[model samples]
Target: MTHVLILGANGQIARYAIDLLLNETDAQLTLYLRNANRLSNLQSDRVSIREGDVLDLATLKEAMESQDVVYANLSGDMEGQAKNIVKNMEKTGLKRLIFINAFGIYDEIPGEFGKWNQRVIGQYLPPYRKAADIIEDSDLDYTIVRPPWLTNEDEIDYEITQKAGPFIGTVVSRKSVASLVVKMVESPGLHVRRNLGINKPNTNGDRPAFME
Candidate 1:
């Protein structure tokens, strides 16, 4: 079975993705987080939890070994942590990475509303953008997913666009982002070495056509 390592496993999006992967896919999963207590209930035969900070290169490298893919859904000092992840992955020869980023990082958000979004949420964008830059520059095969405003709504319908492409909407459910991450892990050919933006499409109150 394919082995996948998830960083920030206790995070909301990461938790949802882990649930999806555990139930839907056959991939062996290892969850790496700063606190294992938060993930006490997630233990399973196929799931293993490791307590360690991503900023600690030794811990990250140890966790990344023999892992086919790494999904990073970390918050806080994301840029520095992401840089460390890349360095450790490179050291370990773990080439595949899927990084969760936020929209507006490219300044490609459209309309006056986009401007307001930049003013309000802009401060946090730089670190993610810097993280994306690190991944893009690395030799690793990476997929950087830039999602729009996140909601805890229980829906998994959304759309995705490539870098420099027009963003679809302003908000998306965390469920959708989680679904996309699992999908990418299951099928790496779809989005390797690309930075994509994801959002819910404007449609009727029905299941949307595509996600990622």
Candidate 2:
């Protein structure tokens, strides 16, 4: 069985991914978060919860043990968190990582929606971009997932754009992103060293529908 370590396990996207991973795959999971109690209900033979902050290098390294993949669904102090994850993973000799980030980090979103995105969340981009840069500079096999504005819709309708191209669409469902994450977990070789932009097809506009 594959052993996957999930950082920021309590994140909304991580929650969706966890449910799908449990239902669709036989991967053993180590759910690492600041509060273990948040995921206590998920404890089972294949699921283990670890309570510790990502900035805690010693604890983070310990959690990386015997794992095949590391999926990070995190926010706040992203640069610091990314550095710690890279450092810990290097020390522990774990190579595969799946990291979540925002779409406009590369200014890849085009047209009015792109400008609108910057106006709305421009302040948060520096740290997220720094985090992405950290992962990109690392030797660990990594996939940087750039998801557009997210929604809670109960569907998995989405598409992918490579980093070199303009990003498409305005929003994608959380379930869509989760499905993509699970697909990456199931096939470790998939999208290695790639920065993916995920969005719902044909939803392009000046802003996300919800925002409009």
Give each model's clash number: 0, 0
lDDT of 1: 0.86
TM-score of each: 0.93, 0.99
Give the per-residue Cα lDDT of candidate 2 at 108: 90
lDDT of each: 0.86, 0.95
Screening candidate 2 with a backbone cut-off below 3 angstroms (N, C-alpha, C), the clashing residue pairs are none
Model 2 Cα lDDT, one tens digit per residue, 1-212: 89999999999999999999999999999999999989877767999999999999999999999999999999999999999999999999999999999889989989999899999998889999999999999999999999988999999999999999999999999999999999999999999999999999999899999877
What does candidate 1 score on TM? 0.93
> Alpha-carbon error at 156 in model 1, in Å?
1.2
> Which residue pairs collide in model 1, if any?
none
CA displacement after TM-score superposition, residue 70 of candidate 1 (Å): 0.1
**How many clashing residue pairs, candidate 2?**
0
